[model samples]
Target: MKRFGLAAFDDQQDDKEYEGISSAVLQRQNNELKEQLAVFQERLVGFAKKHNSEIQANPEFRSKFVRMCLSIGIDPLSLFDKDKHLFNVNDFYYEICVKVIEICRKTKDMNGGVLSFDELEKGYFRRLNVDMGDLEKSIDMLQSLDGGFEIFEIRGKKFLRSVPNELTGDQTKILEICSILGYSSISLLHANLNWKPFRSRAVLNEMVANGLLWIDEQADAEALYWDPSWINVLHE
Candidate 1:
């Protein structure tokens, strides 16, 4: 028993020593990574400044530069400096974010708080001299805020949701059905999804209450539930 006790103590001491060495090694590695990152950042900044004109003029080049920055855990926008005016990368996305907010507010009455990238491109993207990458980055910034901005995909189509409330699974599924023709009715849900009348109506009514679906009461057979995004597509 005495030998066992001494051996246990020795094992514990070994573990402690190993832990200390591991921590020291990890700390050194972390510091080295930080130093390397700093050097890379400095080089990137110099490169960006040198090619500022090309980045601004060439959309493809700008996108590649933004992607490279992100790959290195750097936000292209964060490179902005008021004193130096390194480049206008920050201003480009900042302006796009503002425009997105304005467009959402302007069409809130028509499309609720959800908007498709398709609709946004038609409305302002063409005039703004921006591309899909720029818009995606702008929306990414918005999503980081507490403002309930989120991007979601349904049936391979992406939609930006601006409201705080999340859509339930059933609601999202119904929207997928609506994507066929941009509208779904109780019969449609029942026939395709095999949902009972009560279940279909319950989900539809809840969606209408949440402003996700608009009711078209004048349908020939039953009330048609429409995603407002479809209306924008029709106009286009």
Candidate 2:
């Protein structure tokens, strides 16, 4: 009887402790949500004021507003309650939505006209504080959306596409080396491989031309950086 009583007491204590931790986590999440909502509200208000006439006249604004709200884990069509779908969404949804909206708004403002897909992406990279190559996977996610953009080529130079995707196998390998070594220099990659140096350098050059890699011209010695999308594959 004594052991049984002690066991029950321990279980109760554990239950109480768990409940406390759970409560604390819930409270923290709620606070974060409140702060995020405040920022969203501020941005929305600014966007409204900045493009009052355009917003009012455009049907796309309503769709985008609803999408933005949904992305932020809120159902714009339903009552404004945070707990309605508590189990259905995670914190990342709200975080990413906030980031996306901020980027979109900034793109709209900076372009001084209707923002193109490429401009929005430029804004996204700037907001995320990531290099263009590092943002490829996240860019893929954006491309999956209805208005996703893609880059096009005119003459010999390539430009940003409204939509982007994962790198090809060879491109992936090149990016992997660049990301891992933090250098995309043709000579470096060639020396590192010690085999097929010229072929590898040519491929790297092609990738740069395709925007799968970027070069840092400001560096005293030029350095190549791979797109972040290839990081996972390289690790595997």
Candidate 3:
């Protein structure tokens, strides 16, 4: 009887100790999580202040910042029910959007509001010495407004198609192929896509009208059509 009592007492003691250990472990984990969140919020504020120029000027870095915030359960672009610190998180992006629109308006006649993303970025920054956040993110933010600003890829290149032009299935296919071939003449289109010459020409001309493709008249003088949106090798 005495031994039984001692064993029971020891078991109860072990249980009590385990409860204490569990509580401590949970508390430590909670503290660690809080510390991590604090650090993240601090980093966000730091970026908004110290790297303001870079965040606004270099779009890739701004995108990375957005990704980082998202990974930490934070969205800088969200405007409602946010902590005060995050209120202005995306203000810089909005400002960049205004400047982008101005540039688009200024160059509307040349490219039908369809400008290369690189050219758009360069043009926007060249005019004013202010920062513009990630072009993609700024574009995303702009969509919430009345402007029909968006990005599209054709012929392996990135174009900021500010107009509301939608690509048809055949047009999309042609751009995809041209993106791979760098430049496609009507003959090449008929050969690769099995398209009739007239059909190929029709599609190419339409793309030119949409400002999705450019006529490379100077390069080879062979009436070659190229999608300037296509990157060097391939863009998908």
> Where does model 1 exceed 4 Å of error?
1-86
lDDT of candidate 3 at residue 52, scale 0 to 100: 61
lDDT of each: 0.82, 0.51, 0.68
lDDT, candidate 1, 14-79, per-residue tens: 789999999999999999999999999889988888887777677788778878997998755555
What local lDDT score does residue 102 receive in model 3, on the 0 to 100 scale?
84
lDDT tens per residue, model 3, 171-229: 76776676566678777877787889889888888878777677877765458877664
- In terms of lDDT, model 3 sits at 0.68
- Sort by TM-score, best first: what order? 1, 3, 2
Q: Which residue pairs collide, candidate 2?
A: 133-227, 133-228, 134-228, 149-162, 149-163, 150-161, 150-162, 150-163, 151-160, 151-161
Which ranges of candidate 2 are over 4 A from the true structure?
A: 1-166, 191-195, 216-236
Cα lDDT tens digits for candidate 2, 57-140: 665874575578678765442312223332222222444444554554554322211223333345344544434443444444
Candidate 3 colliding pairs: 56-132, 155-179, 155-230, 156-229, 156-230, 156-231, 157-229, 157-230
